[model samples]
Target: MSAAGPRADVIDEHVAALSAALHGPARAKSRLIGEIRDGLMDTAAAHAADGVPRQRAARLAVREFGTVDDLVPSCQRELTIAQARHTARTVALTSPFLVACWYLAGSIDQGQAWQLPRTAQLVAVHLAGVATFAALFAAVALAATGTLARRLPTPRGLPLVVAWAGTTASGAMAGAALALVTAAALATDWPLLVCAGALAAASHAAVAASARACRHCARLPVT
Candidate 1:
């Protein structure tokens, strides 16, 4: 009983250091740390079965696991890829709903439907088209970061690419919403306009947060 204490403590300290050296999506980071802990404990047990002392076996496991410096680059890269996948997934999923927000707002409107100016109509169409292409691109990025990653080597700077791609897609969607909202301001009652505005703001805020996390992960020097 007394001997088991230091054995566990050494393993715990090593795991704590590994967890501290990594930063990314919380869920993904936690999973990685847990896997590392399991690996260490398994290795230590194998050593102890061969007549090694528990405490010494634990220390040997840490040495075989490599230093924090050696592990950071690969660990950070995986975390960054996870971040990229998350951002891409967000952009792909919410895109259609943003378009629907405009139609729904107009559908529930209490005021008369007024014809928008030709310029406003054209601009809205253009923005909607851009948003569609952006969303498609985000979907491709998501696939690349996800299923495709398992078969091929991860591309360098993929996190940065996906982060900006998501931001651009969300921004275009927001612009489309703005154009529609401004054009329909006189046609809809205050309540519907407020609803539209609130939806757009909330969606954009979520995209901004996800994109920010992507950026933070991308900026970490994996070398």
Candidate 2:
């Protein structure tokens, strides 16, 4: 029987598995996969140039590229940062809307068309300020703890500071939420109060998730 030639299908299948481990923006993930694929093809071609069989060249390229276990950690860190960025953004974007909703609901309950009562005004201003600060801090945390920051050979104090800043921001949000809910109850704006409570709860959950992801990223070895 004649010997069978090397199968490109096997090489492509290996590349596909390797690509699945990468996580980030769709475009970036696609680019990474394409680069890996090209490199593998080039490696195989080089081996073929040297009279090595195509199947053996593909296997050699994959082996040289490292196993799936070796590739996953790096991808995992990127994925974590991506997730943190997404959650932080969610908190930042939603805070303003939630604050507006609370104010609107309170104004409606009080029969104060667009004009808020003096106490409502004060409370709204305070909540707005807190939510704004939290949003700003979310931006800071995302920037400071991204994948680029984690790639340093020697860990810097900045990551730790960013980690702490994320926790502090989350705490500030929670405290503000609690305060708003309490104030709403005292003002007897029961409907607005409940809305504020829900918003606060959701914000707290988001901040907690973001902080956790950042913490995990921070603990990863600086590579």
Candidate 3:
């Protein structure tokens, strides 16, 4: 019985030491998380006082954290649950537009209108030009998305709306470009139209799926 008692005491001492070590880290992380959350709230409040839209406020709040990639990793390290959740939500909302842009670019690249008449060739060339622009836009969006994923704040509400609206408009322009290219392609080989249309549709669908995932993630309660 005497031997067992000493063994039990030694185990208890070790457990206490381990717990103390864990507690220190936990408290530190909690403090850091609190700071980030408070900062975000303050930014929101300030933006509100300025009569800015909530989305813009959210975006500006995030911008204060620096770039998305830098912010995400920092938040992750601190285990800032609220900050992480908000950043994730922003990314979710914007992913569809990024995906759509990429899809449009690819469609333009593969469209068959370039093989047709002089007018059709000109239209195809224009479509290609538009694709090049979309590629650049996609690159930017990808960087932004990656940054946001890592824990950066993205613009919310009005700014988010404006950004997405701009993206949608760009998509519309891409569609128009596609139509011009399609028309020219049909003047040559009608079969390519099906492939081009499929590519566009598939890309749009992919974006929608990505957007859905982001929305779903946003709705999840933070632990």
Candidate 4:
């Protein structure tokens, strides 16, 4: 009708306001905007059918979507949880690589190809590896298997627990690595120990970074 042009302009303004209020990955923001536009159009169409003027209908539709202040926090919470979930998945995928790196570094330092002694130190290191694997797996499973979606859609349990476990495991892994490197350095030359320690340190750093990111996302203010 004659109001089509003004209706489009109104929709553009609403979309712009909504877009400016959102913050997250570009893909997610785009998808959200698409949904919002669809909703706005539907609302405007409904209002038009009810004999509302086109411009007034568009404004009403925008109002129905809520103010920027009211919607921003909701969008932020969703985006933050999404970021945390993504980081958790990345940590899960990298966990095996990290474990292998730690094992390689530790074995090289111990100067033995396959010597896993029953000593207390060996037991502790093994336990730390097991704990790290378990924690990362739990996080990945929750995110991937739809369990998190069904039960605790907005809860912080999944990401927070994973971050805490990852941090604790990192500390334990670092201690074990230091002990192994020290023992090797005392028994052998420094070159091999240094190389192995560097590799272990790099791997641990990656896991730490992932966990820290997840923790930050989890703590994002929903207010």
Candidate 5:
């Protein structure tokens, strides 16, 4: 982003267009933009050193970089991978806490209130197990798109896989949390209930936000 010349201004506008056309995790997008800017500037500097006018060098650099439409599909691939990895990691990391919250909430009741009904507890436990399995499945997707990516043919629609797995895992976590909340309320474990409620809120919020970004990235047409 040089501010000194009309050609620099043109290149800046070009870069902005490229940025506008992309959507993904902010960090990944920012990193990609930074790399592009640095590259353009470096190329412009090289031309300037070779006796080209600085302004003209900037114009040449912009042209050499190709059009936004040409660059964005490649940039988007990277962003989509970053987004998918982030979502999978969040789901995997949150799974343990999701289970622990339920376990601790139920255990700390101490009989101060009515015991949770056995049937409901069993159902909640099974649902929590489902959530755990989904989280683990997300981890598998993570691996597929990561280290194993180089070793295996990248499956088409891998982003969709990550999105759905993360969504299912987070959705199941929310369901089980809601069920546990009901059981806690029935048992009247106020302190335990609040703790579990907070955990559920924070964990679901993180997973849901990442899953949403993942979903958008998955559905984003080969831009």
Candidate 6:
């Protein structure tokens, strides 16, 4: 009997053990087994292409007998946890910069003497709140995308597309926010203008930092 012949029995034993371990979830176990079988088949095909006899390659693949139902789920959970942690870190890192930008914009408005009409001042505050919320949301989305770009299984081109799109959008938003602040400066009294300008500068700095972080994250090889 060939070495390959002996391997089939070893694989069968392992599969039996896996089935026993997964006794309570037959359907899930079956699915996991199917995935393992497919992976093994792919490996066997590769081996055959590299000159192993078809029968020997099939036998060799039998070594990958056990389903990883429990293991796979645990790995998935861990991945989810890690992703959450990464997102939290990204947000924490970016928030201060955003706040600083807002403050700078406010300072610029103050410098410009932009005394708003009482109604307009209320409107401006409301708008600033909305803008801050939007900035936070955008930052979170960009950071999440950066995380996905690191983890998702995809063609090389897909990640590049996502990363570039995110970077471009971020840059554009930053530019627009700056323009709005500058316009506010021109239109308002000197104090308000100074505050707005300061806020714009802060925002620009935050966005610049975020863009750099995203680029760095994108360049990292997926683990």
- Number of the top-ranking candidate, with TM-score as the measure: 5
Q: In order, what lDDT does every prediction score?
A: 0.75, 0.60, 0.43, 0.62, 0.77, 0.46
Error of 5 at 203 (Å): 1.2
Clashing residue pairs in candidate 5, if any? none
Query: What TM-score would every model get versus the actual structure?
Result: 0.83, 0.57, 0.31, 0.61, 0.87, 0.32
Stretches of candidate 2 exceeding 4 Å from the true structure: 1-42, 45-51, 67-84, 98-131, 140-163, 182-186
Sort the candidates on lDDT, descending order: 5, 1, 4, 2, 6, 3
Per-residue lDDT value at 84 in model 6: 30
For all predictions, the C-alpha RMSD in Å is: 3.3, 6.3, 17.2, 5.8, 2.8, 14.5
Error of 4 at 53 (Å): 3.5
| Residues 1-223 of candidate 1: C-alpha lDDT, one tens digit per residue | 5877877899999889888988888999999989988999999999999999999999999999998888889899889888888887787776665665555454543434565522334554565566567678788887787788889877877789888877876686667567556755665454555465456556666676788889888999885
lDDT of 4 at 209: 71
- Give one digit per residue, the lDDT tens place, for model 6 in 46-124: 7778998767776677654324454444433323333333333343444444444444444433444444332333343
State model 3's lDDT.
Answer: 0.43
Across residues 135-212, which tens digit of lDDT does each residue of candidate 3 receive?
A: 445445545444654787443332233234334434543463465445535444444444444444444354333334
Please identify which of the two predictions, 4 or 6, would achieve the higher lDDT against the true structure: 4
Stretches of candidate 5 off by over 4 Å are 1-3, 105-120
lDDT tens digits, residues 133-203, model 5? Answer: 87888788888888999999556588778878777877766766676677666665556655665676677
The 10 consecutive residues of candidate 4 with the worst lDDT sum are: 112-121
Instruction: For model 5, give the 10-residue run with minimal summed lDDT.
Output: 111-120
Tens digits of per-residue lDDT, candidate 2, 1-223, equal 2112453665688767866755444554666667777887788778777988777877887788777668767765555455456656665766675466456445634543433343544555565566677677667656655554577432244444444555655565565566556555555455665576567667667666666655665565433
Q: lDDT at 34 for candidate 1? A: 91
